[model samples]
Target: MSKVWMRTRGWVRRARPLVSLALVLAVLAACAPGPGSERADIKIGVQGPITGQWALEGLGFRNAVALLADEVNAQGGPLGDGRSIVLVEGDDRGDADEARRVAERLIAEGVIAVVGAYNSDATAASAPLYDEAGIIQITPSSTATDLTQHGYSRFFRVCYLDDRQGLFVASLMATELHVKRAALVHDGSLYARGLADWTQRYLQEQGIEVVYFGAVTPGQRDFTPVIQALDESGAEAVYFTAYWREAGLLVRQMREMGVDDVRFLAGDAVNNPEFAQIAGAEAAAGSLISTFPLPRDLQSPEAVAFSSAYEARYGEAPQSIYTLMAADGFRLLVDAMKETGSVDPADLAAHLHAIQDYPGISGPIEGYDEKGDRIGAGHVVYVVTEEGDFELFKP
Candidate 1:
């Protein structure tokens, strides 16, 4: 009996290695990427100037994307497969070189889609990189028309084009403001130059003569020479296709220089609350800006809810309209992903192009045309109030 027991113990010890090998193989098969394997996290990238002059705009976009991602995750995430959305942020500092580098880094990080780089120049410079990678890039605020004209199917924007915005302002100046002549100034940047040219052209087409068309260095504070030119031109309206900083300086100087009789018009760049703060309430009052409608004025439940939620979360009302666009752009991407049941950027782009009249917080995203420009999307007319807030322009 003792001999039999020793033999049995040896047999069991010899079989232990074979049993352990079978268990290891089973575990390996389960862990490998194949049928019934767990899905990895889906990554979405948001790139912007988180530390530069335009950091507010970039941060606003990043915040909106975060909000959307959180909501999606809270709702059990995408595809109902336990797969979650992970947000990866890249700070481009609003520089072209940095933007390209950031774009490449995000691509390497395995982001399927990206939303960001607020400025037109940054977006224009970095778009080719994304196009080469075939990733979807939906800009929340880059409005330069040439961005779409490049035929990069991967690029799309929720904002209106620079030319369309300029034309909208020109139509208002001619039909509503009833101006016979207007003065125009550009910041010499691609966006401002293109906007100024288009607005000038539209004014000319409407028989409203452009009395003075000139350029100015963006960061320059002294606008006395430009104000003098406008004053000498006998223009009934003054349109400056520049940003908030220069717009504020120009408006303040014009007021001080006794050019208050003429209507001061500005572009979407001055649509922020900072514009009013910089220009002063009294000076900013009655100033008209071609912009997108504020969330409060949008009247959609989604818009209203978004405004309230954002204010609650951030402890302040959204100062820039780009936040709304960013949220909408993110929703479009996620909605596409959900609908197609795929995380592929190409799938998202196809669904985005096919999307028609997507009810958005900003407005109805009427889908993208062949040029990737928003179809049937236009700018809103806003006037500064005494409280230094945007009010829907009745006229």
Candidate 2:
């Protein structure tokens, strides 16, 4: 070997162990708090329904975030800070009470941030708990109009909310579907109620007759009452603002009852394979849904890699592309942690406040405004095919 190459190889051999020892010493120095080193590991918390009715969505969030945590770890964690990421996951079981409890527990666990509570009610219920404890909250699927209202300092979302989704559905019905009349059905949950109310108001303002606005209890397997009401009201479309579990059952019952002519428009909650599972191919077929960016339509190589990894791990396609948004939520929290260089919610909230056009795996992200709403105007809609594939539709 050349003399220069020999010298370089000798230098590498001499420096490797010293560098490793220096890194270990620096980690120890981080724990002692000095001006010389950074933290060893930062704990990031994730809260969502790991069990109960929406476990599929909750599990999807968990799986996606886990994948991201691994990726973050592989990159040496938070850049420029010399800190590694350690993810602590909590299961809320899709219950409001459980969400609050999990929020409190995650805060007490010394976590810097939390990922989600998939439903609006759960997010709203747990926001104050996280805010008081200085834990930043980021969710992908909670879309109630007032989610970020009342100045929940740490609350943020990764996708469009009810007001925008409601308008998107209304416009799709009027301009695209050419439907002049409609009915609304919800699961009596806050998320469903908000979307349903907004859809009715927008349709009425647009000169469309909203003949029925109604609710159903969650876990109800029968929909004869609602379907009969819609049929009598002469609605051209029945807008469903409920989760897939209930939406699927309702649609199946409606079809069985011969109410097949009316177009079925659904909310983001129904944008998953579970809907097809519950209602079967024909019952879920021809149904339209509003949701986050489509996974199949993602243009980024990183996004494609995530989708492939998700499919490989789960033995099926991702339930919804919103999983990517949820993953982005956790990523933003980690980014915010790096920006503030501390886990304090107030500092991180300030960092979040200044974020503009953060290019994430899902798409562009804008932090909350004065009203705590994300400043953006893009949410997609998709239609379910009879063969159980989701067809991307322009929102």
Candidate 3:
């Protein structure tokens, strides 16, 4: 019995090694990519302030992207190679530090491209990470001029730069509005300061006197002191380079202080409906806003279809042009993917650089210049009607 037990133990040990080897082989076979195996979905990151102060804009962006993704997936996606596109949302909360963390998270999720970071500071903060990861980033609304100056090939923007917007506002004030004195107020944000600086430079070059150039701390509800100073400056026009919330509050405060004679003008950041809502219809009326073409303003068949589809899906019209701009960015990326027949970041970047006359929902994207800045980007001024609706300014 002892001899038989020893023989059985030796046999069992030898079979144990064979069984372990077989199990390892089976696991490898199951994990290996082959026929009948599921293919990984291509990931795209949508980073924005989904929960914080800029939630409206961020939600609009996410909704637009989601709508487009649904349409594409229904049609078999961009590749037509059996892999669907999956969107990963990263809520940066409009903060620079949070944007960096979001970027890292997106990179870890294996996103090949990113569609946002609405705030200029947030975009600037996260751009390096995307570039380092060889992920393509296309911002829909970040207009800070220095963003494209970073020499990051993978970074692109569908919107115009602050310089272009500044020049446009300066030209409008000098050539059309015929203003001699202008007061410049900014919220001290990176976007606001850069826009204020460029607007100041252009206004000075255009020979308009800058009566009062100052910075206002964001989130300060009472702008009484600034309104008083602005009224004392005797400026004909006031250009507020900041987001919609502060612009609305400032304008409302100005009207409350009986500073009605001064023209209130805001940059593209104030294009949201909340601007007028916060300022009240009477106070918001007649204010000028420099912005890209709004969704309601687009007349093209494609634009009309997009607007209808967006409204049908979301149950309301897109509030800001940034939403449409974000959709355009997604379209451009998909176009590049289709043109190259490859999801390789380098290939997509190259295709984007070479793209010409690509029709976008916003307008004709004349393609990116050497610095990835959109060429032939222009801005138009909109005037708030008595009903608090934006209309293209005729004069």
Listed per model in order, the count of residue pairs whose N, CA or C atoms clash below 3 Å is 0, 0, 0
Candidate 2 at residue 195, lDDT?
93
Model 3 residue 202 lDDT score:
99
Indicate whether candidate 2 or candidate 3 has the larger lDDT.
3
Q: Which ten residues in a row have the lowest lDDT in candidate 1?
A: 1-10
Residue by residue across 1-395, what tens digits does model 3's lDDT show? 11101110111223355568888667666655432234556678899999989999899889988888888877787888866777888999999999999999999777889999899999999999999889999999999998888789899999999998999999999999999999999988889999999999999999999999987887889898899999999999999999899999999999988999999999999998899999998999999999888899888877888889999987998878899989999999888878888888899999999999988888888888978889985799999999999999998
Clashes by residue pair, model 1: none
Candidates' C-alpha lDDT: 0.82, 0.78, 0.88
Superposed by TM-score, candidate 3 places the C-alpha of residue 124 at a distance from the truth, in angstroms, of 0.7
For all predicted structures, in order, the TM-scores are 0.89, 0.86, 0.92
Most lDDT-accurate candidate: 3
Cα lDDT of model 3 overall?
A: 0.88
Per-residue lDDT of model 2, residues 1-395, tens digit only = 11111110111223355568777666555555322135435666767888887787788788888777776766767664556666677888878888888888777666767888888888888888887776778888888987776677777888777888888888888888888889999888889999999988888777789988989998887778888999999999999998888888888888999998888888888887778888889888888888876777787876778788878766876656668888788777778766766666677778888888887778777656865567887778888888977888654
What is the lDDT, from 0 to 100, of the residue 33 in candidate 1?
40
**Residue 180 error for model 1, in Å?**
1.5
